[model samples]
Target: MAYSLVAEIWSELAFGMLVFALRFFTRWKYSGFRGMSYDDLFAVFAVTFWILETVSLYTCSAYGNNINLSVESALAVPDSEVPRLILGSKLAYCAWIFYILGIWTLKGVLLCLYNRLTMGLQQQRFVWVMMVVSVLTFLASLLWHILSCYPTYRAWQIKPYPGESCTQRKWNYVIICVLDVVTDIGMMAIPIPMLLRASLTVRRKVSLVLLFGSGIFVMICAVLRAYYSLVLIDDNTVALGWAAREFLVAAIVVNAPSIKPIFSDFKKRLTENYASGSWKSGTGSNAMSSGLPPYNGKNDIENNTAITSGNHKRTQAYKMSSIGRSQPKSESQDHINTATDADNDSTNSNIGKDGIIVTTEFKVSRR
Candidate 1:
């Protein structure tokens, strides 16, 4: 009894935590991208499943310390009191319907994520086909649950004779289990080929797809649940207990993988923030200035000094050259013309006026 209670508490806590974590991760990873239709729906389905599982667990007293016989014994007082217990049991069955729907919706969300990540029109079409098939299976499962026992209340309340009650159809359980296994397998298999073609490094691609493939654990849980479900047909006390245990275990296992992506995104964000903060604090403004070559420490001082000195020298030279070029051009031109005329007259005096005459040209000769 104590073990049962503990398992019950653990299951509740685990499912709640899984739901929170899955939402955290989904928001962290996909929230930045706009128009994420399926992710939100996935979160809703997760929350719904968690709620149904909690209600079912309580209604069935699956987590409680009392055994089935004890419950029956406690409620053996009067016919009037039996209805309440019976009602509670019926509510438990209804919760199961929700639980099954929750699982089916989760499968849809997973496939949608796969579809978003996968490339190619063909693969996308395949995912859509799977989605349609899964929805149909969910509907079929729901129909079976609703119609399994004619006057379904008989599935809960005991009849006059031990064997006379209209119970759930055996084929319904079989079909539900089969549909579950097929969907689980389909969900697990659909993402592999697309993941293999991802441009990420081989290691990263493998790791990511494997992380997604962790949903197969759900399939494993489903298989175990299905096996124990067979035991439920006998309605033996031990078999019922085992079946409940298996159901809780499978439910927890399947939801457990959803937490990984959430925690992964949290870790990544923390890492990026830490690196950015460290760079900001350590480098300061110097880093920015250093990025420009002209502002580098040694070169900046040298260049500044050279620029000041060169400017001063160029200013002095410009003043001196301006003053020198300020002379009167007309006076300079007249002086040059007078010197040229004197040189011509001297040359004509040395040579006679006529053709043969420079005969008496004064030539100073030193003895």
Candidate 2:
């Protein structure tokens, strides 16, 4: 009993955190943008699922009475008495309605994303068909859930003289399980073709799709829940525990909504770097040159003339100016230009290596 209560509390807390985190991440991702789209649908699903799971937690008496009932006692309670044993069992049924709604909304969003990703019209149409089929399957699940028990309240409540006998059908559960598996596979497969077309390295594209596809882990949890469902057929003790576990796992699975912002930030940084031109090959040299202004031509001539007249300070100044001009644009370039220019400038201050220094002459061309 203690273990069960602990598990229940942990599950509820985990589910609540996942919902909050998904909302936070979605808002963070789209904080700079306006309006809504399919991504926000996932956020809605997360919140909806959180609410439903909270209802289930309450209805299951996860926090309240009968908390000390042994596993055997829990199992012994008949379905008729289970509602009284629990707190919000009736409300839980209503919650499942919303859970089903969230599932349908999620499927629609996944299909829309697939459609946006697929390039060809034919592929897009195929995605639409699959989406429609998934929706119909989900609707069928909803119908089964609603009618699973004739007098649905009998699912939780017990009366002195039960009017109509309403029992759970194994086939109904099986149908829901089948629908889950099919849609899980369909959603997982939808991104493959588009991931293949992404303008990235093969490794990068594969990594991205696999990362996005990690939500398929939820399907694995669903499969496990289906297995537990078989055990739950006649055993409320086992069923309640397994259901709680599955709810927790589902909460974790829906957390894909939170990852969007991380991916968005990465893309944003890449865009900024690309736009700054800092990624160009020769830009580094210009960046370094801009930090230090070059010496003027007049100063170069005066120093060179003083150097040729054997003044050591003037010679040093002339050498420095020559060094600045001959310093190649990059570390890869040779310093031979510096040595030759310095030697010639020292020998004849009147003529520089590149051109003759004409201090008093100007040429004007008219064309």
How big is the positional error of residue 158 in model 1, measured in Å on the Cα after superposition? 2.4
Question: What RMSD value applies to candidate 2?
Answer: 19.7
lDDT for each residue of candidate 2 in 1-367, tens digit (9 for 90 to 100): 3556445745665665766565555544443233344655665675666566556655555423243344455566677756565454455455456656665565665565555444233467678778788878888899887777657655444333222223324454467768877877777766566556543466856765775586577677666666775656554444445545555555554444344545555786687566643322211110011112234422122222222222222222222212323211111110112123345445444433332221122233322
Candidate 2: pairs in clash: none
Q: Against the hidden true structure, what lDDT does model 1 obtain?
A: 0.49
Tens-place lDDT per residue, model 1, 67-133, is: 2333345445466656665666665566567667767766766666556534333577777888888
Among residues 3 or more apart in sequence or in different chains, the pairs in candidate 1 whose N, CA or C atoms overlap within 3 Å are: 25-262, 352-357
Instruction: Compute the lDDT of residue 29 as modeled in candidate 2.
Output: 42
What TM-score would you give candidate 1 relative to the actual structure?
A: 0.59
How well does each candidate superpose onto the true structure, as a TM-score? 0.59, 0.57
Highest lDDT: which candidate?
Answer: 2
Estimate the Cα RMSD of every predicted model relative to the unseen true structure: 31.0, 19.7
